[model samples]
Target: MDENYSLAVPFYDLWHEDGHVPLIRELLPPLLKGVERSVIEIGAGTGLVTRVIAQETPAEIYAVEPALGMRSVLVNRLAEDPELLRRVTVLPCGALDVEVDEPVEAIVMISVLQSFPAEQRAELWRVLARQLEPGGRLVFNWRERAVPVPGDLEVMGSYEVGRHTYEVAGQVLEVAGESVTSRFVYRIRQRGVVVSEDEAVVTNHWPAEERLVSELEAAGFSRDAAPEGMEVWRLP
Candidate 1:
């Protein structure tokens, strides 16, 4: 099954009103330090991290994304900033499908690894391995499964950008097998009356850290020093 997140695609940024922009900008500089040649970012959703990487790193960046709706937003973001437009080349495809002529200095997939199933994780690593230059680093997060707990719902306070008001709510949908699914509901009100509503269901895999490290090891990667929940692997 494909990792489709098109339901709440229109308001994807709206749902993330938890001061994510500054947070990511602050966190990305350290992750991309010491890289000067080139970098590739997978699943560059809404170009948040991609934007930061472009700004912080003096390297050419290739951002691969499969979702059309998110790509639309990404393109808009690029257009708004000429510097980002000049530095980044947004590819309309997933990581596995991207074609890199030269091995990259780094591969970044932040908050995106959990979307791949365990069976597919190996292949994903293999594809990324082919794109990495010797001594290249691959950084991503390994999320732990902690959702769908009985009667748990988050009221993600409403937001108003000019005239359109967004009321967002979320809850854990289920914990099935190796994946935990979360659902987000967004209601758009132009003038109080409900104009539109959307639901986005996202499922993420949370394999044991040991299992993931083993998979990476099998794919010829060595773990680097990083905080918990972060995986920084090097290609030999």
Candidate 2:
């Protein structure tokens, strides 16, 4: 699955502007405060989470994102604010491309693990294992399927930004084993007239929860007690 988030950058804001803000604001602070060294955030996206981290923690941050369109939007946010610029470094790279001078105290991936192509997911986990310092934390969330091999349609919701109205609708395109491919169609209109539209098809690698925990163990992580809806791990 090739996801060019650059093409969807314009609608990215409409789709998820502050969508995960409360979750990020709530989940990230305690984790960052626990880490004495730096924190690296995989898939920084539009940088709202990054902004929160910058505001809440004193730790330096590596905000890694491979998509230029999303990166530009996030970088612009850093430029617009002194706080983000002071503590955050926007890295133009993805999971495998990560290389930091110092081993980090934490590695966070929010809504990023599923996007890794199925073939490369093992390596992705391996990289995550290697990035953290001993006793360091790895925090992430998984895409939950209501049932095995789900094929369903979702309204996804819509919103208005300024005078423009955006409607986001999506449906399941295919389900292969544990993985599901979905299609999203975005229609932007002004004054009830369609102005622009685009569509994106994404396939996520979703395995069963047991298998996922097994994979993380195989990648050299032992699970630590974590809150519901999140996974926390520590390196031996």
Candidate 3:
């Protein structure tokens, strides 16, 4: 996992609540209807999607998050709800190293695929497959994307936090085959003056639909119909 999230943790929920969380709320519940045993959430950031999964089912949840900053918020979020505190377990480990006591019924990875590069995806699929029961579902958000063109910096989101405003800006720095290197700038302003600023250069992989299908298929997964931007596959 990219430890870069340590820089984005402060502004994550503020940005994603309106970005992709709503789509997960709409498209993921149906897939969990019969999942009553256990479920694993790969990149469970700050308990947003974890809360959604908890509400939809009574299954035991293993929320895997490796970033210390994000995991702290996630643990605190779960503490607020006594039921969630007892039902959810937070794993402080990366995807390739994470493990569960037993195979789970389903696995959810929302906006997490980009963290794995083309070279590691095969190992990722293999790791995930080992943790799931045969026929268990692997669900995540994915959409085919055209290669990006390098672009200048642009402010992606700005939020008011009490007397200060937090701003997140980004720029596409370079594009390699399936990897896109980008820079994210985080700034805090007080009355329009920049107070504190931090930047992180991260690389994300966006494989095409055909490549994704090929990889998943090679790992013994069969695709299932899902909403336009969502993907669901079953381990056979």
TM-score per prediction, in order, is 0.89, 0.91, 0.97
Lowest summed lDDT window (length 10), candidate 3: 1-10
Q: Over the stretch 38-143, how does candidate 2's per-residue lDDT look in tens digits?
A: 8899998988777776776677899998888788899999999887688888888888989898888888888787776667877988888788888888888664
Per-residue lDDT of 145-177 in model 3, one digit per residue for the tens? 878999999999999999999999999999999
Off by over 4 Å in 2: 1-3, 148-154
The CA-based lDDT of model 1 is what?
0.80
TM-score of model 3 vs. true structure: 0.97
What ranking of all candidate models by lDDT puts the best one first? 3, 1, 2
Top candidate when judged by lDDT against the true structure: 3
Candidate 2, residue 224: the lDDT equals 80
Q: Which pairs of residues collide in candidate 2?
A: none
Poorest stretch of ten by lDDT in candidate 2: 142-151
Root-mean-square deviation (CA) per prediction: 2.4, 2.1, 1.0
- The best candidate by TM-score is 3
